[model samples]
Target: MLLSLEGLEKRFGGVTAVSDLSMHVRRGSIHGLIGPNGAGKTTIINLLTGLYTADGGAITFDGTSLVGLAPPDIAALGIARTYQNVRLFKGMTALEQVVTGCWLRRGVSLWASFIGLAEARRAKKATEAHAMALLERVGMAGRAHELAETLSYGEQRRIELARALGSDPKLLLLDEPTAGMNASEASAIGHLIRELRGQGLTVLLVEHNMGLVTEFCDTCTVINFGRLLAEGDPHTCLSAPDVQEAYFGRRHDADRIQSLR
Candidate 1:
């Protein structure tokens, strides 16, 4: 397993965001976390990335204990994620944003970065080359010099993916990576994610696109009301009685969620 969460739990005051959630992500595979709104999907991501501390249980990534670690520390442990909303430095070029991600691998000291040590200076140049390669990998090389703010929403999301890839993560978390994309754009993103898998990167996907989930994810864990509802092959999980009940009606409305298609 590249990632493991065992009996994890989180509470926001009186509201339980995630309760006793547990799952394992096989290395080099795409795992889907699917559910309706407020199912604690992103909360699990936050817990894995160390944005929020788990009240109980354990998170082990690549053989390292991740519970209670800081975000930067978790990131340095080779986990990278993109948000549901596009987040980029408006003033910085796409390449520059990715270069910042490369700093994780470069390991430049604060003093060296401030005083511009010879090694740090060398790393700056190397990072640019690495960043450009990442941009090329995501088919954004032509827009490398463009400000992230100037890009379209889908384009910006691609740049965000490139930025995440710059860190050379062993496991990647994508929160609704195609949230605002059209069908064509969503398909493109799906293809890009498959490309990453071909390159041996493990990915945890949280998207409502059922077509993509069934086709792209080898395994899925479904959640509803902060609890696990089903776990298995994507198609099987999606078809499970409890999962259907979670999304649709027990009275046979026949209004299947389009994402399931």
Candidate 2:
């Protein structure tokens, strides 16, 4: 396993966001996490990324324990993630934004960076070249010079992905990568994610798009009301009675949910 969460739990005063959540992500595979709203999916991501501390649990990455670490520390360990809402610097050009992601890997000190040491300058150039390559990989090379805020929502999402990839992560956690995208744009991103897995990147995706989940994920884990409901192959878990009842009750159009499969 590349990533493992065992008996994870989180609570906020009286509300339990995630309880006894546990799962494993096989190395180099795309794993999906799905559930209805407020089902603690995002909470699980936060816990794994160190944005929030787990109340009780164990998170291990490549055999190293990850409990109580800071977000930057976790990120330094080759775990990278993108937010549900795009979090790019609005004023920064796409290239600059992506370059920022590689800053941690650069060895120059702050003073050296300001004075532009020979090594620092060389590192900056190399980082720029690497960022541009990542942009091309995600189909955003043409927009590298544009401000991040000016791009369409889908394009902005792609830029964020490029930034995350800038760190050369071993594991990537994506939250709603295609949340507001149109069907065509969503499909494009779905294809891009699958391709990333082909390149040996392990992906853990928290998404509401069942269509993309079924099409891309090798396996999935479903949760409802902060509890695990099902875990298995995407197609099998999607059709499980517990998942159907939790996600497609009488209040929803069952046919619409079924059509997604």
Candidate 3:
């Protein structure tokens, strides 16, 4: 396993956001985490990224404990994630944003840059190259110099993805990467996800799009009301009576959403 969560629990005052969530992500596999609204899906992502401390549970990455680490520390451990809503450096160019991420991943300390050290200059060049490569990989090379806020919603999502991948994560977490995209745009992201998995990147995807789950994810876990409901291949998991009911308000509504738009 590349990532494992055991008995994970998070509480927001009296409300339990996630309860006893236990799921393991296999190495180099695209693992899907799906649920309807308020299913504690994003809560789990926040826990994994260290944005929120867990009230109870264990999170292990590559055999290293990750329960109480800070956000930056968790990110440094090769776990990168995108938000359910796209987050980007709105004032900076897309390439610059990715370059900033690359610098952190490259371990270019602030002290190294403050003194104008020799290695800092070398690192700058490498960071720029790395950012460009990531932009190209995510089909954003043509808009590398555009300010992130000026891009279309889908374009900004692409830049956010490029920025996350610039970290060269061993395990990537995507929270609705295709949320606002049309079919073609969403399909592009799906294709990019396939490429990432093919290159041996383990992914934890939280998506409403059943098509992408069935297409890219090797296995999926369904959650509802902060509890594990089902786990297996996309079809098997999604077809369960509980999943269909919780997912679609009824069993047959599943057919209406071959994909989510």
Candidate 4:
């Protein structure tokens, strides 16, 4: 496993968001983490990224414990994520937004940059080139100089993805990545994700789009009310009665599930 959570627990005041959840993500594979609304999917992403501390249990990445590490520390260990909602700097260009993501890895001191040192200039130029390449990878190179706030929602989503990739993560956690995209746009993003996996990146995707889940994920884990509900291939897991009930209702709302297909 590339990542594992054992007996994980989280709460907000008296409300339990996640409860005794245990799951594992295999290396270099696209794994789906899914459920209905408020299923604690985003909370798990927060916990993994060190935005929230785990109340109990353990989270291990590779062989190291992630407990108590700060967000930047966790990121330094090669874990990166895209937000559930698109997040981009208002005044920053698409290229600039992505450059910030790799700043920590630049190794050039602020003093050096401020002093206009030749070595710092070289590093800055190299970083910008690399950032441009990432923009190109996400099909946003032509818009590299455009302000992120001015782009379409789907375009902004692509920029956010490129920014996350700037960190060169070993594991990428995507939270509702295709939330506002049209079917065609979402399918394009799916193809990009598959390309990333082919290039040796691991992805843990939290999505409501069952079509993408069924088509792209090699395996999946379903949770309801923060507890594990089902686990296996997407088709089997989605067909389970309990999974259907959790997603729809006791009435089974089969039509709704079918519509996503």
Candidate 5:
């Protein structure tokens, strides 16, 4: 597995966000994590990214134990993520935003840059060039110089993804990448995700778009109230009676949720 969570538990005071939950993502595949609102999906993402520490359990990535590591350390370990909400540096241009991510992987010392060394200048130039390439990869090259805050919602999403990709991650964790996109925009993001998988990048996708989940994910893990409820092929697992019950009130509402795909 590229990433693994076993016996994971997280509590916020009296509320248990995740409890004894476990799941795995295979290398070079898209794995979907889905559930209704307040199901602890975002909490799990927080735990994995080091924003929140696990109370009890283990998180392993590529054979390394991830518990207690700092967020920067986890990111340096080749794990990168996009937020459920678009997060970009307010004043920075699109290319500059992604360049920050490149710096995470290949940065010259601040002292060297401050001294105006030739080598530091060369490295800075190379990093900017690479960031531009990433922007192009996400179809944002044309908007590379635009301030991230000024872009439309969907456009900002593309920039966020490009920035994440700048880290050259072996595993990408996407938290609702298609959250506010229209159908065509969402489909474009899905295509980009598939392209990444084709290049051997593993992904753990947390999305509510059932159509994207059903069509893009290789495996699906369903959770309810922070507990694992179902796991298997996306279509079949989602079709299960219990899974339907958790999403809707009863069997009849199943069709309504199922229609999302």
Candidate 6:
């Protein structure tokens, strides 16, 4: 396993966000986490990335415990993520925003950066080159010099993905990557995620876009009210009665439900 959650739990006062949840992400596979609103999918990402301290249980990545570590500490361990809500440096150019992610792995010291040391300058140039490649990979190369805030919502999301890729992560956690995208844009992102997996990166996806999940994810886990409801291949898990009741519940469009079957 590349990542494993063991008996994880989290609560907020009287609300339980996630309870006794445990799962494993196979190395180099694309895994999906799906559920209805308030199902604690994002909460699991938070706990795994060190954004929230687990109230119980342990998260192990590559055999190391990840309890109580800070977010940056987790990033440094080769775990990178993009948010459900796009998080880009609004005032920064697209290149600059991605360079921030690349900085995580650069060995340059802060003092050296301030002093414009030769090695630091070289590292910055190398990082920028790598960031440019990632942006190009995601079809955002033309906007590399544009301000991050100026792009369309879908473009900004792509920039966020480019930035996460800049970190050279062993495991990528994506939260609702296609949250507000139209079908065309969502399809593009779905293709991009498949490409990423083909390149040998392990991905854990938290998304409500069943079309994308079923089309791209190698396996999926479903949660309801913060508890594990089902886990298996997307085709089997999504059709399970417990998942259909908790997620679909006759609320989805007929076409959507029919597609699942």
In order, candidate lDDTs are 0.90, 0.91, 0.89, 0.93, 0.92, 0.91
- TM-scores of all predicted structures: 0.95, 0.95, 0.93, 0.96, 0.95, 0.94
lDDT of 6 by residue, 16-78 (tens): 898999998999899999999999998899898898999998899998899999998898888
The residue ranges of model 4 lying beyond 4 angstroms of the native Cα positions read 251-261
lDDT, model 3, position 244:
83
Error of 4 at 170 (Å): 0.3
Best-performing candidate as measured by lDDT = 4
For residue 11, model 2's alpha carbon misses the true position, in angstroms, by 0.5
Instruction: Assess the local accuracy of residue 148 in candidate 1 as a C-alpha lDDT between 0 and 100.
Output: 89
Residue lDDT tens for model 3, 1-261? 998889999999999989998998899999999999999999899999998999998999999999999998988889999998877865899999888777565666789988978888888888898999999998899999889899899888888888888878999999999998888888989989989899889999999998889988899999998899998799999878898889678666766664654
Per-residue alpha-carbon lDDT of candidate 5 for residues 1-261, written as tens digits (9 for 90 to 100): 888999999999999999999998889999999999999999999999999999999999999999999999999999999998888999999999999888785667899989989989899898999999999998899999999999999999988999899989999999999998888989888999999899889998999999999989999899999999988799998888888898887887777766886
Which ten-residue region of model 6 has the weakest summed lDDT? 246-255
lDDT of 1 by residue, 1-261 (tens): 888888989999999998988888999999999999889999999999989999998999989999889999998889999998988986999999998778787868989978989998888888899999999999999999988899898989999999999889999999999897888999999999999999999999999998889988989999997788888799999888788888786726434454455
Please give the distance, in angstroms, between residue 152's alpha carbon in candidate 4 and its true position after superposition: 1.4
Estimate the overall C-alpha local distance difference test score of candidate 5: 0.92
Residue-by-residue lDDT tens digits, candidate 2, 152-187: 999999999999998899999999999998889999
lDDT winner between 4 and 6, please give it. Answer: 4
Q: Give the TM-score of candidate 5.
A: 0.95
Error of 3 at 25 (Å): 0.9
Task: Please give the lDDT score at residue 129 for candidate 2.
Answer: 95
